[model samples]
Target chain A: MSGLITLVSLMYLVSAACYVIGLHMMRTPKTARNGNRVSAVGMIIAVIMTFLIVINKHEATMTGSIVLAAGLILGLAYGTIRARTVEMTDMPQLVSLFNAVGGGAAAAIGTFDYLSLTAGSHISFAFSFPVALDLVIGGVTFSGSLIATGKLAGNISGKPISFPGAKLLNAIVVIVIVAAVVLTIGFPVNAWWLVLTLVASLIFGILMTIPIGGADMPVVVSLLNAFTGLAVAMAGFVIDNQALIIAGALVGAAGTILTLQMAAAMNRSVMNIIAGGFGTGDSNSAAADDVPVNVKETSPDDVGVQLAYAQNVMIVPGYGLAAAQAQHEVAELAKLLTDHDINVNYAIHPVAGRMPGHMNVLLAEVNVPYDQMKQLEEANSMFENTDVSLVIGANDVTNPAARRKGTAITGMPILDIDKSKSVVVIKRSMSTGYAGIQNELFSDDQTHMLFADAKKGLQDIIASTKEYLDE
Target chain B: MSQELYTNIAIFVLSILVGFEVISKIPSTLHTPMMSGANAIHGVVVVGTILIALEAHSVLFYVIAFIAVFLASINVSGGYVVTDRMLQMFSKPKKTDDQKQDGGDK
Candidate 1:
């Protein structure tokens, strides 16, 4: 028995190392898939080892085996189908759902642990305390993630919803959760107070996310992800499980860093994120109004002509492009231009897609070569020497409004697409971005608006280019 | 704290440091996959869930554990599969052999 336990522990160590290596391998594109494979193998090993332990225990029950098998099948089917079928534009909601279920499970574990310990009224201070934190954080992550998914999916208004006493109400909810937690600790023998804390924490999660507007959804999602990580770590502490501890701590720290990155990209502090309400989600853009801005309109043929002859062309994509699933069409266009000897490249903003790396993944799905994709910095310099800049379903990132003082996007970095000799923008409507701000680039003399769905726009441009080039 | 608990804490703290180091190295372009990958990695909690659920005594524990076990497994399996699918899209062979001798560093 001892030997088998030791072997299982060693396998877990191996699994942890694999996760670390897998994440590290993500640094480069070539090794990323292999890295993912490594992590999956690690998880499989960990699952097998745990199953072995369950079977070997003297009180081995068929209940555990049946439950494990059932969960694995359902989870595998749901996850595989969702991942395979989901559109690139919907990645945000999918990820939010993933974070939600994961956190909810962790909280359930915490709740179960606490209940089991206290059913006999033998709760230890050390064990009960972390479980308290686990329940609160996990509960918050679960509900908060669900709300974020709702906002992104448009099921709920992405506009910041405020009540008469939202901030005060939130404060009260926090107080209640905290007070319940303290009471449970004070009277460690009773599990009744723990339920109160759990319910309060869950409500608090909903309250916290409700007032956050759409522009901040990315940050909120990332923040909830971090919260889940922390809760999982707390659950590990309650159970004294090393695998859970290591995985949880790693996730907690990583989620936090990602959240900070998302926040910084929007020129907001982490505190502002927690407070949310940065954008109204009320207007098409944050500052969109009746002020009619002058803009040039160009046909796809003209844009196609420019793309064909330009020494260099850079494509700047945004959430709109993903929504249209135009990556393959855009890629086809880029390929056509490349064949005609035009240098084509893609510019990726740090916070471009609904989630991080969102554009990259979508483009990769269309088999866009990684060599052509440039980061914000790399593409910034290229925009200057470029002849044509193709803007697809993107707004704020290219809106010169970000650079000016006193504007909503002040201090928010933007792509220098205006520097190109000629600019063409394809968009579905005149709607302002999530921030509800109008883009100054739309009115520039060098820029021409080809108002259309991004995929259709790209297709028109591609078709025109083929005919124009062949002639 | 007990010796075992102390050791576990040490592991937790060290893993935090290691995680920050590795995650920082990832570029912004890979952030989504990195986020998803980490999401999958944290599914390790299912082991803890399974351990607790099997020994559950009362009906309350049984129902709660059942749900927890299912949710945890979903997180674990779904996270990995999704991440893998996304990563697979990244390593396609380049079509143009013109050899621009460009400066793309991964």
Candidate 2:
């Protein structure tokens, strides 16, 4: 048993090392492909080792193996189907659901452990305490994560929805869970109390995360993730499993840090996040009145003409690119430009899309070469010397508003797209961004609004540029 | 040999497979945050370990439990810190002049 445990731990160590390599690779848009491959390898190794651990247990039975096989088959089918067909927009929701499952599984495992210990045997007060606590925390995390998944997927509103004394209500639930846990601990034979605690904890988790605003989803995801980790770690304790303990610890600490970072990014307090009700679907979808903004106008043919003849062209992508499903098309366009002997590069802002390095992942999906995807710092420097800056359906990140004072996003920094010599913006319409502010970039003298969906605009430009090449 | 143990093992295997399936669909954008957050919940290992130690009635058990708690705390704390830092950097602005001179958006 010791030897097998050692082997599994060693595999985990190797897997961790691979994760580090993969993280480094993600730093550059070009090397990101390689990074992903490395990470995949690590995951594969971890999976193999996990299997070995499960199989190597001396007392393994046939029922367990059958169960394992069923899970494996079901998981593979679901993952393959989703990976092949799930839209990029739904990715966050899928992830949240997945996280919930993991937490739920861990919590369920703890419950099973408790049930087994008590069944056909004597139960003591000492045994009941830990088991009760485990059931409570795990159950709470599981349900809470489910709600988070629902919210992210837009099945629920993303706005804060605080009711009168929601906090107090949540507090009372927590107290009930604690009280039940204490009862279970004080009377080990009281198995029913543990079950009751589980129910209460589950309710607490849902109430705790439901009211947070959409703007703070990233933070909510992080917090729930932390709860899941702690649940798993607690399970490790009940089973006296070293590997489980170590893995749980790693997860718990990481989740905490992520939650804190996400909260800080939005300039929000963690306490506020716990209080929930921040993003109760207010006016986020209400369209802003399109006040006429100055945008330099240009045609697809003209833009194509510029791209075909330019020495260098930098593609500045924003949330607009993701929304338009334009990444694949954009890659095709870049390829055409490359054939024309034009220097084509993608300048990606750090926070360009909804999440960190989102643009890189989107571009990578279309098989864009890593070297061509430049980070904001590297791309920002090159933009000044570039001949043309093509602005796709991005707004807030490119909005020069971040640079000026007295603005809502003030203290927030943005890409210096304004400094570009010729800025061509391809947007369906002039719309205000998530911050509910108008962008001055649209009005810049050097900027040209192409006024089209990014994908269609790119297609038109691609065809026009092809003509330019033919001529 | 125990049916309960078999049941537990079955559940564990099923959970992982389901987990992997769900994980694959997540957008790469939320990968760090999601992974880091889930890892935090695993900290419950410490609570479990501590509970076991309280019941130990043996010196070796106490030692093992203490070690588990210490390690779990570090993992939980370290992971959360790193994830938070990454998110913070993401929300900050890019340096200006580097972007200004480029005639076109890169």
Q: Quick one: best lDDT, which candidate?
A: 1
Tens digits of per-residue lDDT for model 2, A262-348: 555444578866765422334333324445555567899999888888888999888678778898789888878886788998887
Q: Candidates' interface RMSDs, in order?
A: 1.6, 14.1
Which candidate comes out best when scored by TM-score? 1
lDDT of 1 at A298: 86
Model 1 residue runs over 4 Å out of place are A119-122, A279-286, A290-292, B94-106
What tier of docking accuracy does candidate 1 attain? medium
Q: List the residue pairs that clash in candidate 1.
A: A284-A432, A285-A432, A285-A436, A285-A437, A286-A435, A286-A436, A286-A437, A287-A436, A287-A437
Q: Report fnat in order of the candidates.
A: 0.72, 0.08
Return the TM-score for each candidate structure. Answer: 0.94, 0.68
What's model 2's lDDT at A239? 71
